[model samples]
Target: MWIFGWKGPSGFSASSTAEEVTQGIDGSALTAIVTGASSGIGVETTRVLALRGVHVVMAVRNADAGQNVKESILKEIPSAKIDVMDLDLSSMASVRKFASQYQSSNLPLNLLINNAGVMASPFMLSQDKIELQFATNHLGHFLLTDLLLETMKRTARESDIEGRIVNVSSEGHRIAYSEGIRFDKINDESGYYTWYAYGQSKLANILHAKELARRLKEEGVEITANSLHPGAIISTNLMRHHGLINTVGQMLGKYFLKNIPQGAATTCYVALNPQVKGVSGEYFLDSNIGNPSAKAKDADLAKKLWDFSCTLTNPK
Candidate 1:
Protein backbone atom coordinates (compact mmCIF):
# COMPACT_ATOMS: atom_id res chain seq x y z
CA MET A 1 0.00 0.00 0.00
CA TRP A 2 2.99 2.24 0.20
CA ILE A 3 3.32 4.56 -2.74
CA PHE A 4 5.14 7.81 -3.34
CA GLY A 5 6.60 7.73 0.15
CA TRP A 6 3.21 7.96 1.85
CA LYS A 7 2.83 4.71 3.66
CA GLY A 8 2.40 3.68 7.30
CA PRO A 9 1.73 0.47 9.24
CA SER A 10 -1.17 -1.70 8.13
CA GLY A 11 -3.70 -0.05 10.42
CA PHE A 12 -2.83 3.48 9.35
CA SER A 13 -2.89 5.23 6.00
CA ALA A 14 -3.05 8.69 4.49
CA SER A 15 -6.66 8.85 5.59
CA SER A 16 -6.10 7.80 9.20
CA THR A 17 -7.55 10.23 11.70
CA ALA A 18 -5.71 11.67 14.67
CA GLU A 19 -8.12 10.00 17.09
CA GLU A 20 -7.55 6.61 15.50
CA VAL A 21 -3.78 6.81 15.89
CA THR A 22 -4.05 8.03 19.51
CA GLN A 23 -6.56 5.38 20.54
CA GLY A 24 -5.89 3.65 23.90
CA ILE A 25 -3.40 6.32 24.85
CA ASP A 26 -4.04 7.93 28.23
CA GLY A 27 -2.49 11.37 28.43
CA SER A 28 -4.07 12.45 31.69
CA ALA A 29 -0.74 13.12 33.36
CA LEU A 30 0.70 15.05 30.44
CA THR A 31 0.52 18.73 29.54
CA ALA A 32 1.01 20.09 26.01
CA ILE A 33 1.24 23.39 24.16
CA VAL A 34 0.01 23.45 20.53
CA THR A 35 0.79 26.55 18.54
CA GLY A 36 -1.72 27.87 15.94
CA ALA A 37 -4.53 25.87 17.52
CA SER A 38 -7.28 28.22 16.48
CA SER A 39 -8.09 26.37 13.26
CA GLY A 40 -7.18 23.65 10.80
CA ILE A 41 -4.77 20.89 11.84
CA GLY A 42 -3.89 22.70 15.04
CA VAL A 43 -7.51 22.52 16.23
CA GLU A 44 -7.77 18.81 15.53
CA THR A 45 -4.40 18.12 17.17
CA THR A 46 -5.51 20.07 20.25
CA ARG A 47 -8.86 18.28 20.33
CA VAL A 48 -7.36 14.79 20.13
CA LEU A 49 -4.72 15.53 22.77
CA ALA A 50 -7.32 17.00 25.10
CA LEU A 51 -9.60 14.05 24.46
CA ARG A 52 -6.80 11.79 25.64
CA GLY A 53 -6.91 13.72 28.99
CA VAL A 54 -3.85 15.87 28.41
CA HIS A 55 -3.97 19.46 29.58
CA VAL A 56 -3.80 21.27 26.21
CA VAL A 57 -2.81 24.86 25.75
CA MET A 58 -3.92 26.38 22.43
CA ALA A 59 -1.29 28.95 21.57
CA VAL A 60 -2.53 31.25 18.81
CA ARG A 61 -2.05 34.62 17.29
CA ASN A 62 -5.67 35.62 17.50
CA ALA A 63 -6.98 35.45 21.06
CA ASP A 64 -10.62 35.57 20.02
CA ALA A 65 -10.30 32.73 17.53
CA GLY A 66 -8.36 30.67 20.04
CA GLN A 67 -11.02 31.21 22.70
CA ASN A 68 -13.69 30.11 20.28
CA VAL A 69 -11.80 26.93 19.42
CA LYS A 70 -11.24 26.21 23.13
CA GLU A 71 -14.95 26.70 23.82
CA SER A 72 -15.89 24.40 20.93
CA ILE A 73 -13.60 21.68 22.23
CA LEU A 74 -14.97 22.07 25.74
CA LYS A 75 -18.48 21.59 24.43
CA GLU A 76 -17.50 18.26 22.87
CA ILE A 77 -15.41 16.92 25.77
CA PRO A 78 -16.86 18.31 28.96
CA SER A 79 -13.83 17.31 31.04
CA ALA A 80 -11.23 18.31 28.46
CA LYS A 81 -8.56 20.50 29.98
CA ILE A 82 -7.85 23.33 27.53
CA ASP A 83 -6.43 26.84 27.81
CA VAL A 84 -6.09 29.57 25.14
CA MET A 85 -2.88 31.56 25.32
CA ASP A 86 -1.82 34.40 23.03
CA LEU A 87 1.21 33.67 20.90
CA ASP A 88 2.06 35.51 17.69
CA LEU A 89 4.86 33.51 16.19
CA SER A 90 5.86 36.17 13.64
CA SER A 91 7.24 38.59 16.22
CA MET A 92 10.30 38.03 18.41
CA ALA A 93 8.91 40.22 21.18
CA SER A 94 5.69 38.24 21.13
CA VAL A 95 7.56 34.96 21.28
CA ARG A 96 9.58 36.19 24.24
CA LYS A 97 6.53 37.52 26.02
CA PHE A 98 4.57 34.30 25.52
CA ALA A 99 7.46 32.19 26.79
CA SER A 100 7.84 34.47 29.79
CA GLN A 101 4.14 34.25 30.59
CA TYR A 102 4.14 30.47 30.33
CA GLN A 103 7.28 30.17 32.45
CA SER A 104 5.72 32.35 35.15
CA SER A 105 2.80 29.94 35.35
CA ASN A 106 5.20 27.18 36.58
CA LEU A 107 3.48 24.55 34.51
CA PRO A 108 5.31 21.31 33.80
CA LEU A 109 5.96 21.19 30.08
CA ASN A 110 5.44 17.82 28.50
CA LEU A 111 4.83 18.59 24.82
CA LEU A 112 5.61 21.57 22.69
CA ILE A 113 4.18 21.36 19.15
CA ASN A 114 5.70 23.90 16.82
CA ASN A 115 2.72 23.63 14.50
CA ALA A 116 2.14 27.22 13.53
CA GLY A 117 3.44 28.45 10.16
CA VAL A 118 2.88 30.55 7.09
CA MET A 119 2.84 29.34 3.49
CA ALA A 120 3.67 30.96 0.17
CA SER A 121 3.07 34.65 0.40
CA PRO A 122 4.34 37.87 -1.10
CA PHE A 123 7.72 38.85 0.22
CA MET A 124 7.56 40.68 3.50
CA LEU A 125 9.41 41.14 6.74
CA SER A 126 8.35 40.24 10.24
CA GLN A 127 8.41 42.80 13.04
CA ASP A 128 12.00 41.77 13.67
CA LYS A 129 12.89 42.63 10.04
CA ILE A 130 13.50 39.01 9.13
CA GLU A 131 11.70 37.39 6.21
CA LEU A 132 8.13 36.66 7.31
CA GLN A 133 7.95 32.96 6.48
CA PHE A 134 11.40 32.18 7.88
CA ALA A 135 10.79 34.24 10.98
CA THR A 136 7.39 32.85 11.88
CA ASN A 137 7.72 29.30 10.65
CA HIS A 138 11.22 28.68 11.99
CA LEU A 139 12.88 31.42 14.01
CA GLY A 140 9.97 32.06 16.37
CA HIS A 141 9.59 28.38 17.15
CA PHE A 142 13.38 28.14 17.47
CA LEU A 143 13.42 30.89 20.07
CA LEU A 144 10.42 29.54 21.91
CA THR A 145 11.97 26.11 22.18
CA ASP A 146 15.23 27.60 23.42
CA LEU A 147 13.42 29.60 26.08
CA LEU A 148 11.45 26.57 27.28
CA LEU A 149 14.23 23.98 27.17
CA GLU A 150 15.13 24.14 30.84
CA THR A 151 11.50 23.77 31.82
CA MET A 152 11.04 20.71 29.61
CA LYS A 153 14.25 19.13 30.85
CA ARG A 154 13.35 19.81 34.45
CA THR A 155 9.87 18.38 33.99
CA ALA A 156 11.22 15.25 32.35
CA ARG A 157 13.88 14.66 35.00
CA GLU A 158 11.60 15.25 37.98
CA SER A 159 8.52 13.50 36.61
CA ASP A 160 10.50 10.69 34.98
CA ILE A 161 8.38 11.18 31.88
CA GLU A 162 10.08 11.73 28.57
CA GLY A 163 9.24 15.11 27.06
CA ARG A 164 8.42 15.55 23.35
CA ILE A 165 8.77 18.39 20.87
CA VAL A 166 7.14 18.06 17.46
CA ASN A 167 7.94 20.40 14.64
CA VAL A 168 5.31 20.37 11.87
CA SER A 169 7.45 20.62 8.79
CA SER A 170 6.23 19.96 5.25
CA GLU A 171 7.30 17.84 2.28
CA GLY A 172 7.55 21.11 0.44
CA HIS A 173 10.92 21.37 2.15
CA ARG A 174 12.45 19.78 -0.90
CA ILE A 175 11.49 22.67 -3.08
CA ALA A 176 13.75 25.16 -1.36
CA TYR A 177 16.20 27.28 -3.31
CA SER A 178 19.43 25.69 -4.47
CA GLU A 179 21.36 27.21 -1.60
CA GLY A 180 18.93 25.75 0.90
CA ILE A 181 18.48 28.58 3.48
CA ARG A 182 19.81 31.69 1.76
CA PHE A 183 21.15 32.86 5.12
CA ASP A 184 22.79 35.97 3.78
CA LYS A 185 19.73 37.17 1.88
CA ILE A 186 16.75 36.21 4.00
CA ASN A 187 15.23 39.66 3.74
CA ASP A 188 16.17 40.38 0.17
CA GLU A 189 13.03 40.49 -1.95
CA SER A 190 14.72 40.82 -5.32
CA GLY A 191 15.86 37.20 -5.21
CA TYR A 192 12.81 35.84 -3.42
CA TYR A 193 10.36 33.36 -4.86
CA THR A 194 7.36 32.95 -2.60
CA TRP A 195 7.08 29.19 -2.68
CA TYR A 196 10.83 28.72 -2.42
CA ALA A 197 10.91 31.06 0.55
CA TYR A 198 8.23 28.98 2.20
CA GLY A 199 10.20 25.86 1.32
CA GLN A 200 13.29 27.27 2.97
CA SER A 201 11.35 27.89 6.15
CA LYS A 202 9.94 24.35 6.20
CA LEU A 203 13.43 23.01 5.54
CA ALA A 204 14.62 24.98 8.53
CA ASN A 205 11.91 23.34 10.65
CA ILE A 206 13.36 19.88 10.02
CA LEU A 207 16.89 21.12 10.54
CA HIS A 208 15.95 22.73 13.82
CA ALA A 209 14.39 19.53 15.11
CA LYS A 210 17.37 17.47 14.00
CA GLU A 211 19.88 19.71 15.74
CA LEU A 212 17.81 19.93 18.92
CA ALA A 213 17.43 16.17 19.10
CA ARG A 214 21.19 15.83 18.70
CA ARG A 215 21.88 18.36 21.47
CA LEU A 216 19.38 16.76 23.88
CA LYS A 217 20.93 13.35 23.30
CA GLU A 218 24.43 14.71 23.81
CA GLU A 219 23.36 16.27 27.11
CA GLY A 220 21.72 13.01 28.23
CA VAL A 221 18.39 14.81 28.56
CA GLU A 222 15.41 12.49 28.58
CA ILE A 223 13.62 14.46 25.93
CA THR A 224 12.91 13.80 22.25
CA ALA A 225 12.53 16.22 19.34
CA ASN A 226 11.18 15.17 15.96
CA SER A 227 9.63 16.71 12.86
CA LEU A 228 7.11 15.55 10.24
CA HIS A 229 5.31 16.35 7.01
CA PRO A 230 1.61 16.64 7.86
CA GLY A 231 0.52 16.01 4.28
CA ALA A 232 -1.07 18.38 1.82
CA ILE A 233 -4.20 19.53 3.62
CA ILE A 234 -6.82 21.60 1.82
CA SER A 235 -9.05 22.77 4.62
CA THR A 236 -6.36 24.71 6.47
CA ASN A 237 -6.21 28.50 6.12
CA LEU A 238 -2.61 28.13 5.03
CA MET A 239 -3.72 28.70 1.47
CA ARG A 240 -5.16 32.12 2.17
CA HIS A 241 -2.17 33.75 0.59
CA HIS A 242 -2.69 32.12 -2.78
CA GLY A 243 -5.85 34.11 -3.53
CA LEU A 244 -7.37 33.00 -6.85
CA ILE A 245 -4.80 30.29 -7.33
CA ASN A 246 -5.71 28.82 -3.95
CA THR A 247 -9.34 28.52 -4.85
CA VAL A 248 -8.55 26.94 -8.19
CA GLY A 249 -6.03 24.55 -6.72
CA GLN A 250 -8.34 23.50 -3.90
CA MET A 251 -11.13 22.86 -6.32
CA LEU A 252 -8.89 20.68 -8.41
CA GLY A 253 -7.15 18.92 -5.55
CA LYS A 254 -9.76 18.67 -2.81
CA TYR A 255 -10.33 14.95 -3.27
CA PHE A 256 -6.63 14.20 -3.11
CA LEU A 257 -5.78 16.43 -0.16
CA LYS A 258 -6.02 15.18 3.40
CA ASN A 259 -8.64 16.51 5.77
CA ILE A 260 -7.68 18.46 8.86
CA PRO A 261 -7.91 15.50 11.23
CA GLN A 262 -6.07 13.21 8.85
CA GLY A 263 -3.45 15.84 8.25
CA ALA A 264 -2.84 16.02 11.98
CA ALA A 265 -2.45 12.26 12.42
CA THR A 266 1.30 12.14 11.88
CA THR A 267 1.84 14.91 14.39
CA CYS A 268 -0.24 13.17 17.07
CA TYR A 269 1.44 9.87 16.29
CA VAL A 270 4.91 11.37 16.75
CA ALA A 271 3.79 13.23 19.84
CA LEU A 272 1.99 10.49 21.85
CA ASN A 273 2.76 7.12 20.31
CA PRO A 274 4.73 4.70 22.50
CA GLN A 275 6.09 3.07 19.36
CA VAL A 276 8.24 6.11 18.67
CA LYS A 277 9.52 6.69 22.18
CA GLY A 278 13.26 7.49 22.20
CA VAL A 279 13.14 7.93 18.43
CA SER A 280 14.45 11.39 17.68
CA GLY A 281 16.20 13.38 14.96
CA GLU A 282 14.05 11.90 12.20
CA TYR A 283 11.48 12.93 9.65
CA PHE A 284 8.04 11.33 9.55
CA LEU A 285 5.29 10.93 7.01
CA ASP A 286 1.86 9.33 7.12
CA SER A 287 2.24 8.31 10.78
CA ASN A 288 5.56 6.56 10.17
CA ILE A 289 9.24 7.40 9.92
CA GLY A 290 10.33 8.41 6.42
CA ASN A 291 13.32 9.90 4.73
CA PRO A 292 13.61 13.55 3.89
CA SER A 293 15.67 15.06 1.10
CA ALA A 294 19.44 14.33 1.19
CA LYS A 295 19.99 17.98 1.95
CA ALA A 296 17.66 17.70 4.92
CA LYS A 297 19.69 14.84 6.32
CA ASP A 298 22.87 16.90 6.25
CA ALA A 299 23.95 17.22 9.89
CA ASP A 300 26.49 19.90 9.09
CA LEU A 301 23.79 21.99 7.45
CA ALA A 302 21.52 21.44 10.43
CA LYS A 303 24.18 22.61 12.85
CA LYS A 304 24.90 25.62 10.69
CA LEU A 305 21.23 26.52 10.59
CA TRP A 306 20.98 26.05 14.36
CA ASP A 307 23.86 28.40 14.99
CA PHE A 308 22.35 30.97 12.62
CA SER A 309 18.99 30.67 14.33
CA CYS A 310 20.50 31.21 17.76
CA THR A 311 22.17 34.37 16.56
CA LEU A 312 18.96 35.62 14.98
CA THR A 313 16.82 34.82 17.98
CA ASN A 314 19.26 35.93 20.68
CA PRO A 315 21.64 38.54 19.39
CA LYS A 316 24.06 40.35 21.69
Candidate 2:
Protein backbone atom coordinates (compact mmCIF):
# COMPACT_ATOMS: atom_id res chain seq x y z
CA MET A 1 0.00 0.00 0.00
CA TRP A 2 1.33 3.40 -0.96
CA ILE A 3 0.59 6.29 1.39
CA PHE A 4 0.86 9.88 0.30
CA GLY A 5 4.60 10.09 0.52
CA TRP A 6 6.86 13.14 0.80
CA LYS A 7 6.85 15.37 -2.21
CA GLY A 8 9.77 15.19 -4.54
CA PRO A 9 11.82 18.17 -5.69
CA SER A 10 9.05 18.81 -8.23
CA GLY A 11 6.67 19.44 -5.27
CA PHE A 12 4.69 16.43 -6.52
CA SER A 13 4.44 13.03 -4.94
CA ALA A 14 2.96 9.63 -5.71
CA SER A 15 -0.50 11.01 -4.95
CA SER A 16 -0.33 13.83 -7.52
CA THR A 17 -2.83 13.52 -10.35
CA ALA A 18 -1.95 14.18 -13.98
CA GLU A 19 -3.95 17.40 -14.15
CA GLU A 20 -2.55 18.60 -10.83
CA VAL A 21 1.03 18.14 -12.00
CA THR A 22 0.47 19.94 -15.33
CA GLN A 23 -1.53 22.93 -14.13
CA GLY A 24 -1.21 26.15 -16.18
CA ILE A 25 1.01 24.66 -18.88
CA ASP A 26 -0.22 25.98 -22.20
CA GLY A 27 0.76 23.49 -24.91
CA SER A 28 -1.38 24.97 -27.65
CA ALA A 29 1.36 24.84 -30.26
CA LEU A 30 2.72 21.44 -29.28
CA THR A 31 1.61 18.17 -30.86
CA ALA A 32 1.99 14.77 -29.24
CA ILE A 33 1.54 11.10 -30.25
CA VAL A 34 0.64 8.87 -27.30
CA THR A 35 0.86 5.15 -27.98
CA GLY A 36 -1.70 2.94 -26.21
CA ALA A 37 -3.82 6.05 -25.80
CA SER A 38 -7.10 4.09 -25.59
CA SER A 39 -6.46 2.25 -22.32
CA GLY A 40 -5.08 2.42 -18.80
CA ILE A 41 -2.79 5.35 -17.88
CA GLY A 42 -2.41 5.99 -21.57
CA VAL A 43 -5.98 7.33 -21.57
CA GLU A 44 -5.35 9.65 -18.62
CA THR A 45 -2.06 10.83 -20.07
CA THR A 46 -3.77 11.58 -23.37
CA ARG A 47 -6.61 13.40 -21.59
CA VAL A 48 -4.25 15.57 -19.55
CA LEU A 49 -2.03 16.39 -22.51
CA ALA A 50 -5.09 17.38 -24.51
CA LEU A 51 -6.34 19.46 -21.55
CA ARG A 52 -3.06 21.38 -21.63
CA GLY A 53 -3.97 22.43 -25.18
CA VAL A 54 -1.55 20.12 -26.95
CA HIS A 55 -2.72 18.63 -30.23
CA VAL A 56 -2.74 14.98 -29.24
CA VAL A 57 -2.59 12.08 -31.71
CA MET A 58 -3.86 8.96 -30.04
CA ALA A 59 -1.87 6.03 -31.42
CA VAL A 60 -3.89 3.02 -30.39
CA ARG A 61 -4.31 -0.59 -31.48
CA ASN A 62 -8.07 -0.31 -31.86
CA ALA A 63 -9.38 2.51 -34.00
CA ASP A 64 -12.88 2.01 -32.64
CA ALA A 65 -11.75 2.14 -29.02
CA GLY A 66 -9.50 5.08 -29.81
CA GLN A 67 -12.39 6.99 -31.35
CA ASN A 68 -14.50 6.23 -28.30
CA VAL A 69 -11.83 7.75 -26.06
CA LYS A 70 -11.49 10.76 -28.36
CA GLU A 71 -15.23 11.33 -28.26
CA SER A 72 -15.21 11.08 -24.49
CA ILE A 73 -12.42 13.63 -24.21
CA LEU A 74 -14.22 15.96 -26.61
CA LYS A 75 -17.22 15.99 -24.30
CA GLU A 76 -14.95 17.49 -21.65
CA ILE A 77 -12.80 19.70 -23.92
CA PRO A 78 -14.51 20.44 -27.18
CA SER A 79 -11.57 22.50 -28.37
CA ALA A 80 -9.05 19.68 -28.14
CA LYS A 81 -7.17 18.99 -31.34
CA ILE A 82 -7.21 15.22 -31.07
CA ASP A 83 -6.89 12.57 -33.77
CA VAL A 84 -7.08 8.81 -33.52
CA MET A 85 -4.65 6.67 -35.54
CA ASP A 86 -4.56 2.89 -35.49
CA LEU A 87 -1.30 1.48 -34.22
CA ASP A 88 -0.65 -2.06 -33.09
CA LEU A 89 2.60 -1.90 -31.16
CA SER A 90 2.87 -5.67 -31.28
CA SER A 91 3.38 -5.63 -35.04
CA MET A 92 6.29 -3.93 -36.77
CA ALA A 93 4.45 -3.71 -40.08
CA SER A 94 1.60 -1.93 -38.33
CA VAL A 95 4.08 0.46 -36.73
CA ARG A 96 5.72 1.25 -40.06
CA LYS A 97 2.38 1.72 -41.77
CA PHE A 98 1.19 4.10 -39.05
CA ALA A 99 4.39 6.09 -39.18
CA SER A 100 4.17 6.38 -42.93
CA GLN A 101 0.58 7.49 -42.69
CA TYR A 102 1.44 10.04 -40.01
CA GLN A 103 4.29 11.38 -42.11
CA SER A 104 2.03 11.74 -45.13
CA SER A 105 -0.30 13.99 -43.10
CA ASN A 106 2.45 16.65 -42.83
CA LEU A 107 1.73 17.22 -39.15
CA PRO A 108 4.48 18.35 -36.82
CA LEU A 109 5.39 16.11 -33.90
CA ASN A 110 6.72 17.71 -30.74
CA LEU A 111 6.34 14.68 -28.51
CA LEU A 112 6.38 10.90 -28.84
CA ILE A 113 5.03 9.09 -25.80
CA ASN A 114 5.96 5.41 -26.16
CA ASN A 115 3.45 4.25 -23.59
CA ALA A 116 2.17 0.97 -25.09
CA GLY A 117 3.23 -2.26 -23.41
CA VAL A 118 2.20 -5.80 -22.50
CA MET A 119 2.70 -7.48 -19.15
CA ALA A 120 3.65 -11.00 -18.04
CA SER A 121 1.76 -13.40 -20.24
CA PRO A 122 2.46 -16.99 -21.17
CA PHE A 123 5.35 -17.56 -23.54
CA MET A 124 4.47 -16.69 -27.07
CA LEU A 125 6.08 -15.19 -30.16
CA SER A 126 5.28 -11.96 -31.91
CA GLN A 127 4.49 -11.79 -35.61
CA ASP A 128 8.19 -11.14 -35.88
CA LYS A 129 8.82 -14.47 -34.11
CA ILE A 130 10.53 -12.73 -31.22
CA GLU A 131 9.47 -13.03 -27.61
CA LEU A 132 6.01 -11.45 -27.27
CA GLN A 133 6.66 -9.15 -24.32
CA PHE A 134 10.01 -7.90 -25.64
CA ALA A 135 8.72 -7.50 -29.15
CA THR A 136 5.67 -5.42 -28.33
CA ASN A 137 7.05 -3.39 -25.42
CA HIS A 138 10.55 -2.70 -26.73
CA LEU A 139 11.04 -3.56 -30.40
CA GLY A 140 7.81 -2.09 -31.73
CA HIS A 141 8.42 1.23 -30.03
CA PHE A 142 12.03 1.08 -31.10
CA LEU A 143 11.07 0.84 -34.75
CA LEU A 144 8.38 3.48 -34.43
CA THR A 145 10.84 5.90 -32.87
CA ASP A 146 13.40 5.24 -35.55
CA LEU A 147 10.82 5.91 -38.24
CA LEU A 148 9.51 9.14 -36.68
CA LEU A 149 12.76 10.53 -35.26
CA GLU A 150 13.45 12.51 -38.40
CA THR A 151 10.03 14.16 -38.10
CA MET A 152 10.67 15.04 -34.44
CA LYS A 153 14.10 16.46 -35.32
CA ARG A 154 12.68 18.53 -38.15
CA THR A 155 9.83 19.80 -35.98
CA ALA A 156 12.33 20.92 -33.35
CA ARG A 157 14.49 22.65 -35.93
CA GLU A 158 11.58 24.44 -37.58
CA SER A 159 9.48 25.33 -34.54
CA ASP A 160 12.34 26.13 -32.15
CA ILE A 161 10.60 24.06 -29.46
CA GLU A 162 12.39 21.24 -27.75
CA GLY A 163 10.87 17.83 -28.44
CA ARG A 164 10.33 15.27 -25.71
CA ILE A 165 10.26 11.48 -25.96
CA VAL A 166 8.87 9.87 -22.87
CA ASN A 167 9.19 6.11 -22.35
CA VAL A 168 6.82 4.84 -19.65
CA SER A 169 8.91 2.20 -17.97
CA SER A 170 8.26 0.47 -14.62
CA GLU A 171 9.78 -0.54 -11.28
CA GLY A 172 9.67 -4.13 -12.56
CA HIS A 173 12.89 -3.30 -14.38
CA ARG A 174 14.69 -4.39 -11.24
CA ILE A 175 13.32 -7.92 -11.46
CA ALA A 176 14.79 -8.81 -14.85
CA TYR A 177 17.14 -11.74 -15.27
CA SER A 178 20.48 -11.64 -13.50
CA GLU A 179 22.01 -10.35 -16.71
CA GLY A 180 19.38 -7.63 -17.20
CA ILE A 181 18.87 -8.59 -20.88
CA ARG A 182 19.21 -11.91 -22.59
CA PHE A 183 20.59 -10.92 -25.95
CA ASP A 184 21.48 -14.42 -27.12
CA LYS A 185 18.59 -16.16 -25.46
CA ILE A 186 15.80 -13.74 -26.32
CA ASN A 187 13.71 -16.41 -28.04
CA ASP A 188 14.64 -19.31 -25.79
CA GLU A 189 11.35 -20.11 -24.12
CA SER A 190 12.92 -23.03 -22.33
CA GLY A 191 14.50 -20.68 -19.81
CA TYR A 192 11.94 -17.89 -19.87
CA TYR A 193 9.97 -16.56 -16.92
CA THR A 194 6.93 -14.38 -17.63
CA TRP A 195 7.67 -11.63 -15.12
CA TYR A 196 11.37 -11.58 -15.91
CA ALA A 197 10.61 -11.17 -19.61
CA TYR A 198 8.35 -8.24 -18.77
CA GLY A 199 11.10 -6.74 -16.63
CA GLN A 200 13.60 -7.11 -19.43
CA SER A 201 11.24 -5.23 -21.74
CA LYS A 202 10.83 -2.42 -19.21
CA LEU A 203 14.58 -2.23 -18.62
CA ALA A 204 15.07 -2.03 -22.35
CA ASN A 205 12.75 0.98 -22.35
CA ILE A 206 15.05 2.91 -19.98
CA LEU A 207 18.18 1.91 -21.83
CA HIS A 208 16.65 2.89 -25.16
CA ALA A 209 15.99 6.37 -23.82
CA LYS A 210 19.52 6.58 -22.42
CA GLU A 211 21.29 5.74 -25.65
CA LEU A 212 18.85 7.76 -27.75
CA ALA A 213 19.39 10.82 -25.53
CA ARG A 214 23.14 10.40 -26.01
CA ARG A 215 22.85 10.31 -29.80
CA LEU A 216 20.51 13.29 -29.98
CA LYS A 217 22.79 15.24 -27.64
CA GLU A 218 25.75 14.40 -29.81
CA GLU A 219 23.87 15.73 -32.86
CA GLY A 220 22.95 18.86 -30.89
CA VAL A 221 19.25 18.29 -31.44
CA GLU A 222 16.84 20.13 -29.16
CA ILE A 223 15.09 16.91 -28.17
CA THR A 224 15.17 15.14 -24.81
CA ALA A 225 14.68 11.41 -24.31
CA ASN A 226 13.92 10.16 -20.86
CA SER A 227 12.21 7.24 -19.14
CA LEU A 228 10.19 6.87 -15.95
CA HIS A 229 8.36 4.49 -13.68
CA PRO A 230 4.66 5.40 -13.66
CA GLY A 231 4.28 3.84 -10.19
CA ALA A 232 2.61 0.51 -9.47
CA ILE A 233 -0.15 0.68 -12.06
CA ILE A 234 -2.01 -2.50 -11.15
CA SER A 235 -5.64 -1.57 -11.69
CA THR A 236 -5.55 -1.74 -15.48
CA ASN A 237 -6.10 -4.57 -17.99
CA LEU A 238 -2.34 -5.04 -17.93
CA MET A 239 -2.95 -7.40 -15.04
CA ARG A 240 -5.43 -9.54 -17.00
CA HIS A 241 -2.83 -12.22 -17.63
CA HIS A 242 -1.80 -12.48 -14.00
CA GLY A 243 -4.69 -14.58 -12.68
CA LEU A 244 -4.15 -14.69 -8.91
CA ILE A 245 -2.14 -11.48 -8.80
CA ASN A 246 -4.82 -9.68 -10.76
CA THR A 247 -7.51 -10.89 -8.38
CA VAL A 248 -5.53 -9.87 -5.30
CA GLY A 249 -4.68 -6.48 -6.83
CA GLN A 250 -8.30 -5.55 -7.58
CA MET A 251 -9.35 -6.38 -4.02
CA LEU A 252 -6.58 -4.29 -2.40
CA GLY A 253 -5.85 -1.73 -5.12
CA LYS A 254 -7.75 1.15 -3.53
CA TYR A 255 -5.64 0.91 -0.42
CA PHE A 256 -2.30 -0.12 -1.95
CA LEU A 257 -1.85 0.99 -5.53
CA LYS A 258 -1.76 4.43 -7.10
CA ASN A 259 -4.99 5.35 -8.81
CA ILE A 260 -5.08 5.68 -12.58
CA PRO A 261 -4.75 9.47 -12.40
CA GLN A 262 -1.85 9.31 -9.97
CA GLY A 263 -0.21 6.61 -12.09
CA ALA A 264 -0.20 8.97 -15.07
CA ALA A 265 1.16 12.04 -13.27
CA THR A 266 4.82 11.22 -13.82
CA THR A 267 4.36 10.71 -17.56
CA CYS A 268 2.54 14.03 -17.90
CA TYR A 269 5.17 15.86 -15.84
CA VAL A 270 8.09 14.44 -17.81
CA ALA A 271 6.41 15.22 -21.13
CA LEU A 272 5.18 18.82 -20.66
CA ASN A 273 6.73 20.43 -17.59
CA PRO A 274 9.20 23.28 -18.22
CA GLN A 275 11.32 21.90 -15.39
CA VAL A 276 12.14 18.88 -17.59
CA LYS A 277 12.96 21.02 -20.61
CA GLY A 278 16.70 20.44 -20.69
CA VAL A 279 16.78 17.12 -18.87
CA SER A 280 17.69 14.04 -20.92
CA GLY A 281 18.59 10.39 -20.41
CA GLU A 282 17.40 10.31 -16.81
CA TYR A 283 14.95 8.01 -15.05
CA PHE A 284 12.14 9.68 -13.11
CA LEU A 285 9.83 8.57 -10.31
CA ASP A 286 6.96 10.45 -8.66
CA SER A 287 7.53 13.33 -11.11
CA ASN A 288 11.14 13.88 -10.00
CA ILE A 289 14.52 12.76 -11.25
CA GLY A 290 15.02 9.43 -9.52
CA ASN A 291 17.78 6.88 -9.67
CA PRO A 292 17.23 3.75 -11.72
CA SER A 293 19.02 0.47 -11.23
CA ALA A 294 22.79 0.60 -11.86
CA LYS A 295 22.16 -1.71 -14.80
CA ALA A 296 19.98 0.95 -16.32
CA LYS A 297 22.82 3.46 -16.04
CA ASP A 298 25.40 1.16 -17.56
CA ALA A 299 26.34 3.07 -20.69
CA ASP A 300 27.87 0.00 -22.28
CA LEU A 301 24.71 -1.99 -21.80
CA ALA A 302 22.67 0.84 -23.29
CA LYS A 303 24.86 0.97 -26.38
CA LYS A 304 24.74 -2.79 -26.81
CA LEU A 305 20.98 -2.84 -26.49
CA TRP A 306 20.70 -0.02 -29.00
CA ASP A 307 22.77 -2.00 -31.47
CA PHE A 308 20.71 -5.12 -30.88
CA SER A 309 17.49 -3.22 -31.45
CA CYS A 310 18.83 -1.61 -34.58
CA THR A 311 19.74 -4.96 -36.02
CA LEU A 312 16.30 -6.33 -35.28
CA THR A 313 14.29 -3.35 -36.43
CA ASN A 314 16.42 -1.52 -38.95
CA PRO A 315 18.20 -4.47 -40.58
CA LYS A 316 20.49 -2.47 -42.80
User: For residues 74-174, what per-residue lDDT tens digits would candidate 2 score against the true structure?
Assistant: 99999999999999888889999999999999999999999998999899999889999999999999999999999999999999999999999999999
Model 1, 1-316: lDDT tens per residue?
A: 2224344653577777899889999999999999999988999999999999999988999999999998899999999999889999999999899999999999999999999989998989999999999999999999999999999999999999999999999999999999999988989999999999999999999999999999999999999999999987546789998778778767765666677788899999999989889999999988988899988999999999999998998889
- Worst ten in a row by lDDT for model 2: 1-10
Best by TM-score: 2
lDDT of 2 at 4: 46
Model 1 Cα shift for residue 134 (angstroms): 0.2
> What clash count does candidate 1 reach?
0
TM-score of 1: 0.96
TM-score of each: 0.96, 0.98
Off by over 4 Å in 1: 1-7, 252-254
